[model samples]
Each structure stands twice: as structure tokens, then as C-alpha cells.
Target: MNLFLDSFWRSVAYCLRPRVIALSFLPLVLMVALALGLGYYFWEGALDWVRGALESSSMVNNVWTWLQSAGAGSLKMVLAPLIVIFAVTPVIVVLSLLMVAILMTPALTLLVAERRFPQLERKRGGSMLMSLMWSLGSTGLALIAIVISVPLWLVPPLILVLPPLIWGWLTYRVMAFDALAEHASVEERREIFRRHRGWLLGIGVFCGYLGAAPSLIWASGALFAAAFVILVPLAIWIYTLVFALSSLWFAHYCLAALQALRTEKELAATTALAAALAPSQTTIDVQALPLPDDTTSDARPQS
Candidate 1:
């Protein structure tokens, strides 16, 4: 519990560091460039498709007619763009997350290690290839969960519960693995996961909620398209910063757990060695003791 809170605050503080803040923008820049380029090429096409689909759908047309009858006709103008925005928002989010994982996690992990655990050994348990594979696999599972859970998202409460939970699970798997990849061996990493699974997942879920904050900007962009040019970059930056903080939190907690695990193993080994040598040392002490007085006196002088 102490470790959990400590790492959380440490990560928050680290996020404020000039270096970490700078690192956060690296991903933001890349993501924003990617977003702008994609938007440039496909934004109009996507909007057109969404508008056509809405217009062609009888059910949607009925809804729009009903809305018009109810004096909410202005919503019709907003619906197609809203659909496009919502549809593309998920992709943008996933891409931003991947960008941070690929670009920022390793650097952030290194920063945390150098600052807090300078003496921690680098076991390189997970290589770059392995980290990428792990992240992709976890992301794939999370996406599957998201797709399967989409229906449930219509439930007001579950909508709040499900997405963050999936994101949290993915975040936990990816960030924890990356944080420990360099400093903890496979066994140590597994042990840390086994021991601290709850706390780690909690951290991930908390960050998952933090990650959701950017969605407000997305929503704002959906409502007021004029500000979207400004909001898109801002949303992407927030996502990057949130993920960066998550990387740092996992790095701190996992590395500390690894250190504690190693210390425990070392202490246990020392104790076993002491136990193993105790009888021998007792025998040596007994052998070195002066002869018993009666036996020695009788043998030496016969009184």
C-alpha cells in the first residue's frame, strides 16, 4: 500500500519534470503529425461516407424526421460529423497509446531507473522485439474485449465501467512488462507481477481514467468543428502525457518490487548458509575447548 501510493505520487511528480514533459511531447509530435496527415487524406471522404450512410438509412431518416418534428432539427446537421468523430476517435486513441508505448515508455523507464534505482541491475529480460510483441498482443486482446463489450457500453453505468477496465488491463500488461524489461529477469518480473498484480492493475485503471480525460476535447471537437484543429493536438498531447505518467508509475513500482524480491532472496540465502554451517561451527568449538578438568588431571598427574 505504501509502495502503491508512493509510486503514484512519484510518477505524478516525475510527470512535472522538465525532461519528462519534454519526452511526453515527442510522442505528441509524432501522433499529431500522423493524425493531421491521415485527416488531410481521409477526413472529407470519411465525412462523406458517414453522411451518405445516414441519409440512406431508413431508420436514421425516420429519427431525423422525428427529431425535426420535435423541433430538434439542428441535431440532424451535427449527427454525421458526430458519427465520424466518434468512429475516428477510437483509432486516434489506440494510435496515440501505441505511439507512447513505442516511443516514450523505454525512455521514461530509463529515466526512472537512472534517477531512483541507479544501482538496479539491467537483466534485459525482455528485448525490444519482445516488448513490442507483448504490447501488440495485449492491445489485440483489449481491442477484442472492447468489441465484445460494445453492446454493454449502451448501459449507462457499464459504459463507464467497461472501457476503462479494458484499457486498464491493457495498460497494466504493457507498462508493467516494459518497465521491468531491462531491470528484471523473467523470473523476477513474473514474481513481481504475482505479488503486486492488484496494485499494478489499480495504477493502470487510475491512469485509464486519466486517459479518458482527453475524450472531452474530442467531444468538444465533435460539437464545435472550428476548434477541432486546436483540440486534436491538445487531446493527443494529453493522451501522451497520461501514458507517460503510467509508464513512470509502473517503472517505479515494478523496479522497487524487483529490488525487494532480490533482497529477500539474498537474505534467505544468507540465512540458509548460516544454518548449514551452525552444526559444524558448534563441533569445532567443542573440539577446541579445553579438556575436562577430571580427565585432564587424572591423565597428567594422578593427583
Candidate 2:
């Protein structure tokens, strides 16, 4: 909890840094703004196109006939391409953003880590792919649970535990691992998550399932698809923000874990130097840390 809270703040501070913030989020905010622009353009087009199709068709002659004859499957057949276009485009945009976010994380850690453990990355831990996979896969599961539970409005709230817990574990790894895995890449991270397919699925089944929302994000988590108007457009933006910040928070944990696992000399050196290099105690965080998982490790960094 302590670790996550710090990591969360670190991400915000790192993002807002006079120099780093300008360097990092300038690209990010611009990209987001551009993507949003493109998204709104296309989304409106898709809506217009769908409405035009429905209006042109005799489907609405009688709502029941339209429903019984042209059911969702039938409508999907007609709108499939549009659905694919609208759906896949946003996904691509979000993935692009994640790529950027992952790249930005190391920059935030570089200054602090260098002043503390100059020889970072000699420590033990999963490979880059392995570590990133842990975080990505966990988040992915959270998404899946949310997607799968769209029909069960009454049950979604009960499935909300998965994301937070899985996310917390991933946060611990990200905060702790980066100090040891400087050479890690985004591709490696994705592959690692792929390698641990079962764990990711298990996370969803066990905990991520709790994150399932009967309602999509923008629609106020509404239980029914009837709320599509509010959910569709805004979900992309809202979910992206939540997921991105959450991923950064997790990354902070693994990065911190990387530092924490160092030796006592490293710890002493860090304790002293951290005051100068560190973002203040309030700046450093442990809330994002995993619940002292024996499933992981706790050795401090070496000087």
C-alpha cells in the first residue's frame, strides 16, 4: 500500500517535473489530444453511418419486428466492418499510448537510481519480458473481466477485487524490477506476459474478475448496454487514464523493489543520498508495494 501510493505520486511528480514533465508529457499530452481528435472524428462518423443505415432500413417499422427479425447478430453482420473499424482503431491508439508510458517510466527512475545504485541491473529477478508481462498481463486480465461481465449488471461490483490486487502485485514487481533490468524493452515485456498466460488468466478468474463492470467505464458503470451512448465515447478516454496511471504506479513499485533488493551498503548509501536525490519521504512511496509477498523477495540493493 505504502509502495503503490509513493509510486503513484512519483509518476505524477515525474510527469509534472519542470524538465522531465515538460519533456515527457508534452509528447504524451499532445499525442493524447491528437488521438482524441481522431477518435472523435471517426466515432462521430461511425455513429452517423450507423444511424443512416438503421434509418434507411425498414427495420424500425416495428420495434418488435426489427428486434425479432434483425437481432443483434443480424445487425452486426451489416455493421461488422464499422464495428471493427471503430473498435480496433481505439485499441490501437491506446496501445500506442501504453508504449509511450512504458518508455517514460525509466526516465523518471534514472536520476534517483544513478545517484543511489550506479551499478544497478546486476541484481536478480525475472527478465524484462517476464517483469513487464506480470504487469501487462495483470491489467489485461482486468480489462477482460470488465468486458466479459457486460451482461451481468447486478454482479459486476462483486467482481471488483481482481484489478486492484493483481495490479498491486504487478506494481510491486515493476517498482522493484527495473533497478535490476535496465536493458528491458517493451517487446520483451509483452512476451513475458505472453509466457505467463496462465497466471494472467488466473488473475482474471480469481481477482480481476472483481474488476468486471456490468457497465462500461464512461457510462457510469451502468448495468445495461442501453447506456451505450454515455459509455462508448468516454470509455476510451477514462479507461486509458485509469489504466495508464495504474501501470505507472505498478512500474514505480518494481523500480523501487529493484532498489530495495540491493545490499546494506547500497541501502546506507541510498538512505543518505536519497535525501538529496530522492523526492522527499512524502515523495517516496510504499503504498503501491505488494503485501510483503513471500511469493516475491525483499533483499536491498548493494552499494
Candidate 3:
């Protein structure tokens, strides 16, 4: 608990660092550029397709009629755009997170290590290729989880609980491994992960919940299509910042746990060596006592 809270506060403080603030923008920029480029190319086509689908669907047509009857006909104009926005949102979020993980996590982890654990050894256990593979694999699984879980979303309680949990798990998996990749050996990383899995996952889950806040902007932006241009980028930036903070949080927690693991091992080794030498040292001291100089004592006893 102490460890968790300590890392949490440290991460929060680090996020305010100028370096971190600057680092966060890289992902944001990349996401914005990608979003804009795609928007420019596919904007009209996507809208046309969504409108055609909505118009052709019996269920949606009925809903449109009901909404018109209820005098909320204006909503129908935005419905297709809203659907498109929601559809694209998940992609933006995932890409932003991956960009931050790939581009920024190493630097953040290094910064945390240099500042807080200068003496910590770098085992270079995980390479960039391996980290990329791990991240992609985890992300793929998370996406699959989302797809499979969508049916359950109709259950309101499950809807609230499930997505964040999946995102949390994904965040935990990606961030924790990246956090320890440079400084901790494979064994050390696994050990720290096993020991601190719960706390790390809790951080991920909390950050996952925080990540959901941007959806409000997305929702609002969709409702007000006039503001879509501004809000979409704003939401992407928020996602980038959230992931950056999450990276820092995981970095602090994992690195601290790794440091403690090494310290504990060192202390154990020192104690074991002392224990192993104690009997030999006792014997040497006994032997060095010189048998009380029996000959000299005998010779002097007559006096």
C-alpha cells in the first residue's frame, strides 16, 4: 500500500515535469496528423456510407420515424456522424497509447531510473523488438476482448465494469513490461510483476477510468458536429497525456519494485555469507588463543 501510494504520487509529480509535458506532445501530434490526413481523404465517403446504411436499415428507419414524430428530427442529421465518430474513437485511443508506449515509455523509464534509482543496473533484458511484439500482442487481445464483450454491454452494470477492466489489463500488461524492460532482467521483471501485479493493475484500472473522461468530449463533439474538428484533436491529446501519465506511473512502480528486489537480494546475500563464515571465524579465534602459554605458566608456577 505504501509502495503503491508512493509511486502514484511520484508519477503525478513527474507528469508535471517540463520534460514529460514536452514528451507527451509527440504522440498527440502524431495522432492529430493521422486523424486529419484520414479525415481529409475519407470524410465524405465515410459520411455517405454511414448515411446509406442508416437509411437502408429497417430498425434505424423506424427509429428515425419515431424520433421525427417526437419532434427530435434534428438528431437524425447528426446520427450518422456520431456513429462514425464513435467508431473511430477506439482506433484513435489505441494508436495514441501505442505511440506513447513505443516512443515515450523508454525515455520516461530512463528518466525515472536516472532520477530515482541511479545505482540500479540495466540488464537490458527486453529489447525494442520484443517490447513491440508484447505490446501488439496485448493490444490485439484487448481488442478481441472488446469485440467479444460488446454483446454484454447491453447489461448496464457490465457495460460500466468491463471495458475499463479490459483496458486496465491491457494498460497493466504494456506499461509494466515497458517500465522494467531496460533495468530489470527477465527474471527480475517477472518477479516484480508477480509480486506487484495487484498494485500495478490497480494503477492501470484507475488510469483506465481516467482515460474514459475524453469520451465526454467525443460525445459532445459528435452532437455538435460544428465543433468536431476542434474536439477530436482535443480528445486525442487528452488520451496521449493519460497514457503518458500511465507510463510514468508504471515506470515508478516497477522500477521501485525492482530496486527493492535487488536490495533485498543483496541483503540476503550479505547475511548468508556472514552466517557461513561465522563458525570458521569462531574456530580461528579459539585456535589463536595460544593455549594459555602452558610451558611459560608451568615454568613460572614454581616461583
Candidate 3 local lDDT, 1-303, one digit each (tens): 998888889998999999999998898888899999999999889999999988999998998899989999989888887888877877777888799999899999999999998988899999999999999999999999988998898898997888789889999999999998898899999898888889989999998898888988988987877988999889998998899889999998898888889999999999999999999999999988855777776785445
lDDT of 1: 0.88
Whole-model lDDT, candidate 3?
0.89
If scored against the real structure, what TM-score would every candidate get? 0.92, 0.42, 0.90
Ranking by TM-score: 1, 3, 2
Off by over 4 Å in 2: 1-15, 26-30, 33-37, 49-97, 119-143, 153-180, 183-252, 264-303
Best by TM-score: 1
| Per-residue error (Å), model 1, residue 133 | 1.2
What stretches of model 1 exceed 4 Å from their correct place? 293-303
150-215 in candidate 2: lDDT tens per residue?
A: 355346764354334443343334433443356334544444445443433332233222222312
Report every candidate's CA lDDT.
Answer: 0.88, 0.47, 0.89
Q: What is the C-alpha RMSD of each candidate to the true structure, in Å?
A: 2.4, 18.7, 3.1
- Residue-wise lDDT of candidate 1 within 78-130, one digit each (tens)? 77777777667667767778888889889988988898889988889999999
